[model samples]
Target: MAMPVSDPGRTRVVVTGLGAVSPLGPDLVSTWEAVQSTRPCVEPIPEAWEAFWKPKSRFWAPLPKEWIQCPLLAPLEPKQLDPVSILALESARQACSGGAPAGRGGVFVGTGSGGGASRFENHLNHLFPQKEFLPGRRGGRFNPFCIAMGMPNSPAAMISIKLSIEGPCRTFSSSCASGTVAIGQAAQAIRSGEVEWAVAGGAEYLVDPDGTQFHGFDVASTLTRIPTREECNRPFDAGRSGFLFAAGGAAMLRLESERSARERGAAILATLDGVAENCDAYSPMAPAPTGERIQQCALEALADAGLLATDVDCINAHGTGTEANDRIEAAMLERVFGRGPKVTTTKALTGHLIGAGGALEAVFCVQGLLDQIVPGMPNLVDPIADLDFVLRTQASEHRNVLKLSFGFGGHNVALVFTKAGTP
Candidate 1:
């Protein structure tokens, strides 16, 4: 048997650098170190998202305030950049720390709630100048950069602007799967010879001053709630309720062709082997109850990676700690991998960064491949399915891994990551 050699563009894509600013920690080292704990780092939110009419979210995991305070980000005046954009810039700066000359490459970022902090909220303040209703001036006009600050593509725009990157700068807003899809899209661009390098990841900031973002998810019944402040986000547990939404954070990866990395003498972190996306198109809210589309998506992803289900050794499950999603995702995993792949979820510690959650999890997956470790599910008590879940942080050699993410409107994505030097 013979195999044809592939060109440089289609040869291989490696993650040369990784950066993340999460509630778990500031940089990748701290984040990985924090996961060694058996419990999550979730914290009680201040004031519990007080709205006069609706319920407020009590649990959240937000990055440290000191990292993004106005004084720290001097010269970037207030209202000129949304929190999501600021977070994106920070993460991208960390990933591109190798100082890749800025003239080339692309920037792709994802944010599910990037627009919530827009002037539209101010317009609401102008109309309803009542206290405890909206958190804004009685009747003040917004700054001129209102639209630019809160645009869905603002994160990507900020990354390019700060890093001086040129090429196809784009953003993915496909709900929760946005970050994973953005990375996939960036890999596609390199495969198609569109660029030699790219910045791909996602950032999310839902903790708007007005509590509107929390109100939206709380009204949708997706924000996870627990009876006690001592416990939170029990993903895959039999009594799981929902995901603990983040106050939000960002994660970024600097990806380049293997050839380019070698030429530049960069260290290879991991490989972006394959990716596949599908739409259940069944329901905007509920996943296909049968888990058929998600099952198909997993198979397609493995196929794209030129590997079978048997080749995958670990799954960074998008286990959001929700009842229905956990059940459906568990069932789909059994159907595809037959409970063989070790399942792990870091959402408890990460607090479901919405769009950025996937990118953060993807970073964890790469780290997992490097250390041969899978993080234990925080607060996981009773099992929902007969799957091999990593109950505590431990070492297990994983050569191939699959990361799954599903968004509202049926946006499903599966990304396959292989060990750095695997053939």
Candidate 2:
């Protein structure tokens, strides 16, 4: 259900801070520059991982190793926490660093699979060894804390604890749309007066050391097996094969009510105009062919923002390179915006982060607005549909943007944003 906006004058939600550990870079500035330049960060999968899984997808956008060494993460014991929690903690640290820590606010994070859960499962498999036990076997060798660490709520809880946020803390796990849904829910909470502010975003690190888990996508034939790293991940291109699975990262934004932001003199990066979420109810892993529900979601988000479709100046599309997704999303965009606004997807550079995709792309939208420059779709040599694709960096006076996210369960979400001063 859409969140109830009780009072239009209650408080407008605005983004004050942003933090990210992405394939493009370790920080926000570097990542934004990479996007604007259409830089390619994909490289051959690390040799360590190749030794085990021999995955079909040879290339992926892996984050820098040094990005995780943040001072805010110093308090936690590294081995005890999963990489998911660590990534979220580091990103939240960046988002909350300089001033805006709403003690009474909430923490909301979206993720598909908890790293700790997968970690626990991997170890459990070894510990149990085919679900058999020797006679007189005493207590298993598995780590006792696995249960607590593996819970989906671990990241949210750790963020709340690290930042001392006392308000409602929640996690959304709606597949790939999880992060966007978490951000939407946080904005709703602010509008509903549930809290004055929130730490909202998504995090995911699905690169398993053993490499056994990612083989599922390979077996399903949903991952690209291109020979060269430079030649893959061409979103919207005619030669596109499939999504390039990669090492996932985390991104977070400090979302606060306008009043709180102004009172604290926080630098407003962008205004979160509105967010809409719905489902296709058509298939578990495929989008509706007619693009009906996706179109409805776009309209609903624009309506919530009190604007018409024409007002959207740009669209940060959910343009995964996969054939079905690209075509369906193109159809949906054509139906919604009529090829009027410029469209681009940063996934060409970031790979498919799955859970963290929406959050990182939303960050790109805000950064683009601040700079008035839209990043182009990297490696897009051919068009699959009738749409205006930004193939190179372009400057614009545009103020409003629509960021769309769709997940495997047909979950759809649209977030409308505007420049800080836009009404």
Best by lDDT: 2
lDDT of 2 by residue, 1-423 (tens): 233332467579999989888888888878888887878688777676555456778777778777666666665466567778878888888888787544479999999886744564547556674554534322344555666667788888889987888889999998888888999999999988888999999988776644554666666666776677787888888888888775778889899999998888889999998789999998988888988888888888887887788888999998888888898888778776777898988888788888889998998888889989888876888888778899887797789999999999899999998999876
lDDT per residue for candidate 1 within 1-423, as digits (tens), equals 122223434557889888888887767778888886654767776563553444544777767765573223557554688778888888888888866933259998887877666645666655664544535334445556777876888889878876788798999988888899999988988877788889999988876655677677778888776756556688888877778878788899998988888887888989998788999998887788899888878777777777888888999988887777889998888777777889988886677888999999999899888888888875778988888988888899889989999998889999999999887
Q: Specify the poorest-scoring 10-residue window by lDDT in model 2.
A: 132-141
TM-score of each: 0.92, 0.91
For model 1 the local lDDT of residue 280 reads: 91
State the displacement of the C-alpha of residue 127, model 2, in Å, after optimal TM-score superposition: 2.7
Model 1 spans > 4 angstroms off: 1-9, 54-57, 69-74, 101-103, 128-141
Screening candidate 2 with a backbone cut-off below 3 angstroms (N, C-alpha, C), the clashing residue pairs are none
Model 2 scores a TM of: 0.91
Candidate 2 runs further than 4 Å off: 1-10, 47-54, 101-103, 116-125, 128-141
On the 0 to 100 scale, the lDDT of residue 60 in model 1 is 75
